[model samples]
Target: MELPVVKYNRSHYIETDTGNKVSRKSVIYGSQNITLSGKTIIQAGCVIRGDLRRAGGGQTLVIAIGRYCLLGENSVIRPPHKTYKGVFSYYPMKIGDYVAIGENSIVEAANIGNHVQIGKNCIIGRFAIIKDGCRIEDHTVIAPNTVIPSFSVYSGSPGRLVGELPECAPEMYEARSKEFYSKFMAT
Candidate 1:
């Protein structure tokens, strides 16, 4: 069976054959350093900064997003930056499959694992590691260098582990992600 084509605002975006819907309003710099593994949706007003290379500066990849990932409108995905040896430098950002980032969020995380859900207006700090099947609540601020364990629910301003995910959470996320991908369309 053939897959359905995902339609979008053609004047403002382009939907690739691999199911990548990238809006023209979004700023994706250094496309060479950014890899989208297909079925990724980058919404309007989003900014993905792949221009920042590694600290050593040797043609390293900056942002690598896996399949069925969604970056919501007005959100910013940038590599984590730090001052090392009295010089400011940036590090790479890695995101796994079936991840969804909510609107207006700023993500500077080093790694985001599979089936992770980050809510609206959230702030994921520098070098933070989000493990698989984690759900981050809206307006939460994850501390820099923090590590989130798998199958956990995190919330609050400073971001605390409020609870653990249900046993069926992973399967649920997979279904939901696929459903969302299939339903995303302009008309």
Candidate 2:
């Protein structure tokens, strides 16, 4: 099914040369450390924390989001942190193409693969690795250090493998995300 045209106020967003639409109402820290690929949409009230890194001052990539991705309203995207040798360090979050995260989600994953769809009010725990073609249902809480395999549907509070997706899931997800981006427009 195709998505309906979603319109946003022209004055509320900043459209990039690469076709990314970022909301002015959203708070994105350390913008230089964050990379948003083309055609990505970051909705209002979202918070992307790129400033939460190690003390070393060289430019470390905190978050790298791929093409045709959407981060919904009030969502939080932060890099995962780990304490090693009595020092805390934040690792980069890498999100692949055609990913869509629903409203009110907080994702601190180490990596999210292509065609992944995460639902509303979800909490993807720190250092979790979600593989390609995965669907995480609404209000789900994936545990830390969890590794979600490809082509699976996970749900519930401590998200478990509830079901398996068909082999055609990748193609379907790609089409769906692309269509959503196409219909998302400025009013």
Best by lDDT: 2
Give the alpha carbon lDDT tens digit for every residue of 1-187 in model 1.
2346666766777888988989999999989999999999899999999998864646789999999999999999999999998888888899999999999999999999999999999999999999999999999999999999999999998999999998788778877888888877775
Show model 2 residue runs off by greater than 4 Å.
Answer: none
Q: How far is 37's C-alpha from truth in model 1 (Å)?
A: 0.2
- Name every residue pair that clashes in candidate 2: none
State the lDDT at 60 in candidate 1.
82
Candidate 1 similarity to native, TM-score: 0.92
TM-score of each: 0.92, 0.98
List runs of model 1 lying over 4 Å from the truth. Answer: 1-7, 55-58
| lDDT digits (tens) for residues 5-94 of candidate 2 | 998899999999999999999999999999998999999999999998878868988899999999999999999999999988899999
TM-score between candidate 2 and the true structure: 0.98
Candidate 1 — what's its lDDT? Answer: 0.92
Query: How much is the lDDT of residue 174 in candidate 2?
Result: 93
